[model samples]
Target: MTRIKNLADLHKIKEEVQSKNRLRSSLDYPEHLVQIKVGMATCGIASGAKETMKYLNDELEQQAIDAVVTKTGCLGYCYAEPTIEVTLPGKEPVVFGYVDKAKVVEIIDVYIKRGEQVEGIIPLNFQTIDD
Candidate 1:
């Protein structure tokens, strides 16, 4: 890890992180945009959640898509560690498994952009208390 040498550098780092973590700050996300949650628990990390998250972040920023990208804890599918849950405005959430960089592209082009479904979905097995 690189050490901060001065206050200016520290502030710069802070700004960078805050910019990337906009989802945490925006609780009431815009209703017309998409929202994504990446599973980042221990299992998820071990199975490439970090890479998936990075890819999604870069893609969303590049495409200028109006969406909120957030990191979440485990979705209880340890076998599908690199998992992601996507929610389009006014629709039920869909959980997808084995989300690699390629899958992320499809998710954006087909799921988020075109508002169509794609493969790799992990069907909901158990209903949450909110259900």
Candidate 2:
């Protein structure tokens, strides 16, 4: 680890560390609430999933929304990297794809807040897994 050289450097290091830790632990929120899972696989990372995940965490906190945001492996939609699945309490999960910061905000505002579904949802033509 690099040593802190001054007060500013120390604070910067602390903030960076906190951000990383926040990313890892943000999913620990109670299960009864909504859960937001973002694909963080290699393809997802190449598609800006890291920034999207961070944006979700920060925006959720800023908006005072209490939801769990976690990173997950590939959801098999490589064409739509950076896919996100939102599991609202007592409701079926909805997956959105090709997400960016704007889409992320729209998800939070429309889906999470107003319960309105936006575009980019992968069609569920067939079901293999039984709930």
Pairing residues by index, what is the TM-score of model 1?
A: 0.74
Q: Estimate each model's TM-score.
A: 0.74, 0.72
Across 30-74, the per-residue lDDT of candidate 2 in tens digits comes to: 435677899999999999999999999999999998788989998
lDDT of 1 by residue, 1-131 (tens): 78889999999999987764553334464435577899999999999999999999999999998778889999899998799998876677899999999999999999988988798899889977899
**Which candidate has the top score in TM-score?**
1
Predicted structure with the largest lDDT when compared to the true one: 1
Segments of candidate 2 deviating more than 4 angstroms: 1-31, 129-131
Candidate 1, pairs of clashing residues: none
RMSD value for candidate 1: 8.0
Stretches of candidate 1 above 4 Å error? 1-31
